[model samples]
Target chain A: MDKKISVKVCLGTTCFVMGSSNLQELIETVPAKYGDRVEVSGVPCLGLCSIDWEFSKAPYVKVDDEVIKEATVEKVLKAIDEKLNK
Target chain B: MAMNTSTPKQTSHLKREILVRLIKAYLSDDFAENTRLIPYDMRPKGSEVPYRCCIHSERAILRDRAIAGLGFSIEETEDSTLLSELANKAEKRDVPEQQPLTVLTTACKGCVPSRVYVTDLCQGCVARPCVNTCKFGAISIQNGKSVIDPAKCKNCGMCVQVCPYQAIQKIIVPCESACPVGAIAKDENGHAKIDFEKCISCGKCASACPFGAVHEKSQIIDVLKNIKAGKKVIAMIAPAMIGQLPCTAQQLKEAIMKLGFADVYEVAQGADITTKNEAEEFEERLMKGAEFMTTSCCAGYNELVDRHIPEMKPFRSDTKTPMYYTAEIVKKEHPDAVTVFFSPCVAKKREALNNPNTDYVLNYEEVGAWFIALGIQVTECEGKEFKTESSAEGRNFCVTGGVAKAVQTLLPEDLPTHPVVIDGLTKQSVRDLKKYAKNGVCDLGNLIEIMACTGGCLGGNSTVNAMKPALKQVTSYVNSSKSIKEQVSGTEQVKQ
Candidate 1:
């Protein structure tokens, strides 16, 4: 019951306008399972637009300190699942 | 409508309204040739016309100066007083009228000839060096006196430099030369004056002037008015604003909230919505064989259309930019909420005015003033209210490929697609867009997303932070968020 995770999403224009902006909102509405651990906020521009090769590869975020380059809710759940298991 | 015979004064008022409308039409391009024939009633009538004191009305000496600066001729008559009244709309007005640069036109006898004021310091010491240096053959020794010919001499400073007496006079200043818009020029007393029309408000001349003659008008008082009213005020910030100050985003949000904004919303949130909408729009347009399309988000690009490429108007989308959309949503939810967009670009000011919902657009430089007036120390505003946007795709509106990235995220995984993102829309970039739009000739993609600014929003003309670091900060922010790392970030994603 002591599970709380800090989820920082780049709300910079590049991130927010892409899908991450919506993703940050989505995180707040996420089912009770991972909702409480997700602390979402918008930061300034981060240089991910440089490394982003594919459109699908972006609008990214991080859990704790690990970078999740591809922004997909399933990938986030996977990462969170691994952490919970550990 | 018939006028009552007893109300002669009311009829004159009606005529004034009609005259104002005619003047407006005359100043517009739509009536360039047919202005004389166009009736005044059709034009915006009455006190609706913005007015200010005629620049030349103050003095006859500066009349030509204003005319030359405005690139228009002025006809002065006994009715010039009425003309000034019309120009100023002093009697009846709603919006702030444009105050024309006040010039002493009555005193100016047109442009003064450079030779008229030549000093008598010609030593006449028989060296004849001054006469020899004259390229125009204007300088000569007449009756043992060095004289300059008014007709033959150019305003070139050669005569002034050669004279041992150092009597040559030049009215021009270095700051005036540096101004690309011709905004700065010498006043009646040879002091500097700024013409806001030609000025892009770039602040270049302000820095160039050794005398510090120019500074931007501050709107801190207006911002404070909204705060004091206790109406909900929000700061919708641009994405490139990251790392601008030493404080964290949370700290900054806290500081802004303390300054009296009921909430702090990220403009990135709007970008997310735009990305979602634009990506779909592009997919549909491309598949429907709309061969060439341009991004409509950039105000400069929109201006280019209105000024240079009116033919491409059909290609432009009606969808508003992210900032406008975000402000619209905020106003919709909170009708009383005054939205102030914090952007790096001055064009955003123009855009904000055009946007129906946005109340104000403050450049990053104004943020310091806003904080100072509120007595809020940004660094000391501990903790954050946690203002966040929708998704990582939404957050991508800041950089060059942001739109494309959002589109890609929205695309169904199994769809075979060649989506191309055209970054940094220069003239060359448009050529590239045409090449990609070619059917079967270019395999780049049917779907293309274009951004006019280099490096995208981060590279906007108004941002305070450099694009490189801002981009990095965005990336780091994205990498740190939890929901974007998961697959179900969107409601649509959940259904999928």
Candidate 2:
């Protein structure tokens, strides 16, 4: 019931190698500012490129239902900042 | 002064231009003189794996015919520029070209009329029959007039027909009428269904599908893992990749490295090797009384033969494709490293997976999608040099006759032999080749180089963008690089 935002990263062959797995490690153990409202997870290929874009780009991650490109620790945090009010 | 229709001189000049452009686009062969050929002991173990360097040999003929249709001369310099300019007009020229209507019905809703063009003659019919016939009750009378209930009407034409006035028009979407293949079938809800079997994968439907529901597959997820693993990943790039990418080949390689691949290698380099080996193999085959020899570089062409010309199976040369061959060498050198093949062909998916050496194979279309999915703009990575071995012969593998040109280096100086090169292997051409093989009347001199698609890998089904000019650009790019000696030496700034 707590208002926790979950970030799921695709560790499929493309994402994991493009540093998605590493990015997930970076996302874990959040800073004090966000407190316990955030959580991170790793998932399989969401078929984003396959069904949505068709291998035009990659290194993607998803926050709940939204997709983020060029997935990195900085970008994911920035995305988390935009969605949540400080 | 005669508006010269029969200008053989002009036509021959134009033909040269076309061939040059084609040579640039296909970029099939390089290193016609010197390159290592694969040893016979390492040939692919199963029939599932393609053994020939030539794919779709018939398609080469299509490219030749397309070039011949222009009536240009190979000897003319000016014709070279013109042909190169138009070499990859396949999809470009086809943009305005529409598909037939039967296929169109698969995706389109029936035409709807633009504003009710009700005639002035719509008299206040005493019967009120038109309004009564409207099932949806779309027609309604305005003011004192007996106007139909427009909102309730389903636009079934029942109202229009009921009205003695005859007033109704429809607007249609051109896309719905363009697909000749019934692959694009409509659903009960009016969306489209893409039957893969029915679909020729011609992409006409994707182009025409206004909603953009149908699309090519993506392989970004697969590519990302190799980059992050931090292994010595070598990207074996297809020759057509030279100019088509927004950045130069070096820059694209740099961008890929920035994303984290260990190194980049050109598959054309493998072609340089393949050409020499296959030429030698062809000679040996002829010596052994093997009357017919077909190049097998093209996976689709191989599939075509397997599916259509089972009898011609013996004619296909037993050489692994350049991609596979190069992967094999890389695999041997860096036992722990992974190799990724970046090609313009979709069938390469099948090719890469089957090759024990190729860790992964993703076409240009899939890579393009991955770029979008990752939000990595290739332009941002521009100007970065993606380091590679300098090999001119390997780089020229992007065009038609490239294999033949490359193999010519292996042929003896005075061998009295004639080899035929076929481009764009269509269904008809394969049948023709079979006929020639069966009749023993083939003038190919027992050796035929076949590319399944029109421009070989440049014309593969999975490519993300146009590949014509890219072929020429890569050839020049290859020419600027060091000779084949620099590729295998692995001494060009080798990093542990």
Candidate 3:
């Protein structure tokens, strides 16, 4: 039995305004091969902006507790792949 | 919000950003005293040259843009009035008859007209195929190179096709190339000017202009004023708006309410009504042995038929558009409420102006600006749980073929229905439509769905997201909704 990969995309004001609006749709469209293993959801605000990390941008995504900075479709997918394989 | 890498997209986005900032400032507490310096504040003394020849010229263009943002036509005013004075004038006026689109002459590049010319690659062949192929004697050999006579040339491009070197090439102005209705043409000074009669207000020209010279006049201030004056303003959200902003539809509704809208109604619900009505009308027409019925949801498509293909108007579905149906519902339920349509189209601005039910219109970009100016973080807002009784099919109206799909769902499965979908209204599509209208041909399909924008409403010029992502969002949103039967089963019939 494989564990479902939990993917949380930040939908905070900063993230949304910074172009995270498309990420939800992008996550929904993750390849059918990963469909059964990955679960994608949107968090209103990840509160990453409060953290002063240089890479803690608005569009932060956490794939199974591994927070990916400056997240895009490709970055998130890659993170999902790494977690699923791990 | 991902920065568009393209220069033209960036410039247009900047223009919208500046307008939003200006509108936000105007609505602030100390606006009266600081209004005069808004343009200057936006483009301070030492700002880098953004677009034009100099910083001053850029600021001038910004000033004109600010004026257009206030719902005033730049063509009507040349006065060196202060921003405060302009604001005061804007406040005094009723909802003015606004032209859907305007061009800022200051920013116009006055691009050269599209012309076929022999390039340096022209190898002056002894056979003179270029000269021989030209019916108008426009091509001649000069100094061992082919020369096109501008005076004698009919721009037929026959010589180019006949030339072995393929030296002849055509140069097209971006706005002229983008206009499907051929509304934009060069003036005496070579600046692009729109013929309003021929213009469908598709806004393709505005988006296509690399210089960002073309603009759609906004009614932001008017709508704001209405809100401030305690008028009950009901927002009729378009179907395409599902994925336009970052927030969910519920959150977006709450954010809209925070912007002082009395209530939010999904235009998708109205689309559901349109689907039912259009399907019934189609069946009736088919039974009556009518030629064909074209869907009438897209304002650009409607306008194209109205202005360019009047003969096809009879074949166009008599049912009202989703927006109209939505506005009808809103106006009837809340008669005093001012219905403001939030669309993803510039053509809808014109449509709203002509409509009695809809009092004002705002595109996704303009409303996004409003959200920014008001400091309304959409994602952070606690969304109200109000949902419309619109079906999945109705909400799917944002994408290409969505209408046909919705109509198909309503019609009987065994019905001999042949549907044709015209995804985008290009020159060739218009020609075909005109030919069909002239010939009264019903062989292709009993029902034809024509979307003016390439990807339907989601592909509207003012949309925030790109087409592919937006379509994905819309599709998922539709998939999550209830079926048409469940949504529209008990709803009262909206008066036509």
Candidate 4:
């Protein structure tokens, strides 16, 4: 089965400042791990920061429509794992 | 903007988040009211207090952060003071504080006092080298395990060096360990406190704290208020611009202009002036039989001399900084314009306050916040070409060995100028400088260049990029620019 999982890493100011810069590594690692099964790209802003403004779980990333808050390499990779397995 | 330190700490991210939010609030409709809502907005009623123990404690820390952001003294402010009131006061503030750093008392971890510890690896050997090596009897064998008495231990770390098993280790407070001047320490409450009298304003402690507690009193409100009032705010961008945003210099210029800056002048132009004058001064000093002279561009180094090593005053160069010369040129040309310098560290903020030509200072972090607040992408900006381009030497001033090399290139072939670079200031380097000053001669080299940050300005506390990438970008800029030797000769030919 050729599964298509699209991951959009939020590069917005809030996300970037909230340690999303570290997640940029996932842009490379995701493709290396999942091969053609996943497509990774950096998006400007998820616009979820203001929506989640009260408790800024900034640096959000979307893995196949699933928003990952307080994102990390491990968290992003785990999300990719669940989606791939699903 | 996001930074890419080899080990990017969460504290830096937390600090940036607060700055971005504060800038967003300031740009919003109701500055005072909105600024007050920051902590509540960030840590609303049911948020998981990720950092601190409780939501209330987290909010207290955020409140203190807001106080620092509004350019107020965190130590001086009463706990009862509301953020809304401070915002109003900040809006009307005419001048910034002289001290550049403020500690968030609630956020400081109040780390256990640094002491020599005997780890589990300790064999409790019969030689008892550790006990013997310790000048102070702080270590003793207890139940076949080495034990250290906190009160008796001087934290000298001699025992750590002598341990054969290497089981002994010294635990240090990051802020206290990073400070070269011994300016910051734990107070009665165990919260970090800075002795401003001894602080070199290097911002080492500000960047060192893991809790992101130390804050720079920002004049962002002052700069924004002027820009909002239709003042002609001209940005004097430092040589580190290329190392900041991912964009061409021309494009970065356009992006700065997009954010209400009437114009942008590369501080490198001022650095060129600094280079020429400093070269002349060095030659003059060398010819006068002086043994050596140090470069005077690093603001942190200048402050270190003023506060801690006054004896080195004579050997230090008296030339003004690049920001100074840049602001001078801007004022000379546009007398009515308000000058704002884009700096990479906190020392420049203190430096700008002293210079009449400079009106305000913004770190790379603040400028990044401003860009975010305005939703401006530098990479997408239309490139604006500069009328007069700077020499490679001027552009590379932010790099270690840049100033020394720039000066060395300008001297006559027979001048015998040997340049030595002090990569970064530390307790050892500070002691060496004092010794050099006391002896009135340096055997290492006749010309010494000392940069406070390890990799020069690119490694500054507030820089958004990592060392390798920043250096790569800056090197590209330097390679494309004309060399200083040719530029200097061209200018002299024109004058003749």
Candidate 5:
């Protein structure tokens, strides 16, 4: 059985207000593109913005163990491909 | 303020970040001092200059953004004045200034004046449809290329539409084009300037500008100062708030209280009164042989009627807005309480400025920033029921057809209302309304629901969430609430 990659899209206030509201399409689009190989879900804040508080690079998404900063639809998909090949 | 319901842009992100930073600084121990560091902190001395020509230019625009965030008019603000001085002034100001929006000259792209011109694609067809379509003698074929005389052109765009090759194009200044009324135009500097007399405070210009140059002078510091003074600060939340955050309305109520609000009144509770009064007014108007009566809850639409379309006066319902009624009730209950209206758009800021009862207007974005500043996760907050619950229809006043539907439900039997919702008034729709008023008859419908922002109040400039989720959240919240009919009859039964 192929390992299913987990993706968590941050819907936290900071992230949503930043730009994750734009990446919401990926929740549906990722599932259709990669099928059962990847699982995508909108989660609450990952607490990543607080870690680097000086100047926030918000709207972060998590692909498996990797935390993608300033996440976009294309960025998440690319990160997923990198993992699948690995 | 990012008003686009279709997609939230990067400019929206930048705007939110500035607000968040400003609020954080305001909440800090040294508000005036920390506020000074906002532009520098956001863009450090040696940081990467991602947006503009240089780091200095980016910081200049950010400084202007902070000034707007501090609730001062950018156009009137001098470049020499420091941000700390503005912060101090914002804290001391008795009332907000004129013009809800201010143009950030530093950020303005100064888009070339919007005009019709013959593009390179013009084949200079012998058909001469371009010349024939030109009513102002603006188009002439010269050197085998169709040229449009800018001086003579009225920019009616008829030639652009009639062109066979589709070569004729209208280059639009986004902010200028977005205005339903021709309120914003370029000065000799080629930057945008708003005419206050013609402006309606619809915030269309703010949302339309990709440059994010148009800014709503925020009233955040005023609300915060009052809160800090240990005054009885009451929050009158708008109906559109149900869709803004990831929480139930009840949860939001609790979350808001955590922000130090003495009590939070659901504006929906007041919307119940508006719904009833508008229904009574509509019925009376119809009985008096009036062809149609438009809903008057939208502040932007009211501004249009006041300034641009006086003809719409008789047709417009005389009922006060839900915010007005709600603020009145809040004042009556707590005469000494500092009343702050939590709204979805800048139009309400203008509306609040006119009303004596409304002390200040805080938009959804500011509220979201406040939540972030205080680290209050609305989704995690325990739900606390509102003391006065609003009916489903009253709660639905945020959407386009809500007001008309509320009125129609009351007159469902005898005078079945034919509702015609005017979603997002545009140049064409504004003209249509004028015609309806001039004729004193509307064949389209007997009830007109005019919302200035497309998709109603939820699609306001200050809203954070996208359209679909916001709609879904609001719909679920409405479905759980009681109906207006049930509430009205319940009151009658009690009175009897």
Candidate 6:
């Protein structure tokens, strides 16, 4: 059995303001074969905004504990692909 | 001087977010139970106030915004019911009025009247040209400055012109300044009021108002209700929706289908037909020795001509809009289906009101919110490759000069067709159009293309992205399409 990938999206105000409100929708379009293996959840403020690093931006997403910043639909999909292939 | 940067863009985004959430809630099974508490849930007592004086006022404004989103204008009613109650009543109504735009008085800052005022630069010139220019004794020397009497001043700006120091400055209300036809004015209470009779529903005022007092009444709830009732809702996607979402047009279609829309059709298909028909009409008109002809694709420009420039009406091409043609095709294919034109302009909302073929209009912003609320990621969706026979020229109709270019391409190479493209409508452009209308012909061009919004439909008020990038995306998309010959052949095959 394939291990399920848990994906957490930051719903912080900063992230929401940055147009991350619709990132959850990306979960719905996962191919039917990988549907069960993917789990998507919305988490309030992953606290990425508080970080001082330049790479740490709002709209942070964590896929199986791997944090991705400035996440777009394509970027998140690519991340999911990497996880599924691994 | 306000600390809040409540620009019109931010205000529009905020309103769209609330509406999206509300629509999502309405679609849920537990909608009836939780409908009343949406405003409070969105804005709690302890939450930070973004725009208004306090959290309560902010919540109140949100409630009113949500009400406007649900397609009902908030009248000055004596009923003291909660906003949720009003939403409940609004949701149950069969259909909303045809009023496309409304003013949220609660959100209005009630700005000062638009007038010309004296500034500190007033040198109290010995010449006193300001006083001489004023036919009425409105200007007077007071405290080493030229003061204009508010009652006597006609706001004619003659004093502004005559003053060599340029001391006089015009303080314009943002909404009033944005309106091309002077339709928006202050009511007795100083709140921004829209005169529906004079308003062209161009949505310029809505985009111009810093307070975001003016709003386009949405038809999302009505569309949702129809979908919930198990009706086949066909989405006629406009050409302007090319790069609005973070997905290709094919992927966007698949995502829309996921939202319970029976199917999706591109309005560019209609644009192809319009191009052919309009080109033929143009040639016929020119042969008959008629003056220059204008493109009729822009509903805002059409409304402007209808309302203001009456003489120009005769010269406008009598071609039905792309949405009209597309909706007709949808109706022919599925007689039972309700056709909703997914547009990128506010004027189309008003256009849809009079159009029997198109049942409803949803702007790109509302559609984006809907996608977000439904958790339908268009970019992630496997693109459903529907065969499109639309030409590059037809698909280019979303940008400035696209219509003229398309028509010019269809015309014979030898024809004397000089195209004049009005990239954006301003007071100056309107004056030029009026000049052409009065003079019958201008040396500039015999074929005129007037786009109300700068950069055409991509720069429409409801568009999500800025103009420059969106234009690039649209141009690339158009370039990628099939040639005009191939498209015409495919369209003919479809008709047969």
- Cα lDDT computed for each candidate against the true fold: 0.51, 0.53, 0.78, 0.84, 0.86, 0.77
What are the models' TM-scores?
A: 0.48, 0.49, 0.84, 0.91, 0.94, 0.82
Docking class of 4: acceptable
lDDT of 2 at A76: 79
Best by TM-score: 5
Candidate 5 lDDT, tens digit per residue, B382-415?
8888889889998999988988898887774868
Residue B477 error for model 2, in Å?
1.4
Compared with the true structure, what per-residue lDDT tens digits does model 3 show for residues B1-496?
3122111254554565565666666787855445556567766788767556877776677778877776677767765866667777777778855577888866676467778977888777898988898899888778988888899988787876887888888777788877888999878787789999999888888878877778878888788889999999999999999877765778888999999999999998889889989988988888898878899999999899999999998899988889998999899899999999998889998888789999999887778777756657787778886555678988899889999889888898777788898987767888899998988885689789999887888878777765666677788888888989765566665446
DockQ comparisons of all candidates to the true complex = 0.01, 0.02, 0.17, 0.28, 0.51, 0.04
**Structure candidate 6, residue pairs in collision:** A25-B375, A25-B377
Q: Model 2: per-residue lDDT, tens digit, B1-496?
A: 4111111121222222222223222322421111111111112133122322333322232233233222222212232243334333321331111111112221134333223445556666667676687677666666534564456545466666676656433232323333333445555656455554444333434333433223333333334444545567777777766644445676677766655677777776677667656877878887787777787777656655665566777788887688877787688778888788887654565556467787666555445434433445454455555334536766666677666666665567676556777876544675687797677557656567777556655655444333434565666786787665444354442111
DockQ of 2: 0.02
Docking class for model 5 is: medium
Give TM-score values for chain A, per-prediction: 0.64, 0.75, 0.82, 0.90, 0.92, 0.81
> What TM-score would chain B of candidate 6 score versus the native chain B?
0.92
Cα error, candidate 1, residue B136 (Å): 19
lDDT of 6 at B100: 87
Best by lDDT: 5
Ranking by DockQ: 5, 4, 3, 6, 2, 1
- Residue B290 Cα positional deviation in candidate 2, in Å, after optimal superposition: 3.6
The residue-level lDDT of candidate 2 at B39 comes to: 13
* Residue B50 miss distance in model 1 (angstroms): 39
Evaluated on chain B only, what are the TM-scores of all the candidate structures, in order?
0.55, 0.55, 0.94, 0.97, 0.95, 0.92
Please state the i-RMS of candidate 2: 18.2
Task: Please give the C-alpha DockQ score of model 6.
Answer: 0.04
Model 1 global lDDT (CA atoms, 0 to 1) = 0.51
Classify candidate 2 by CAPRI docking class: incorrect
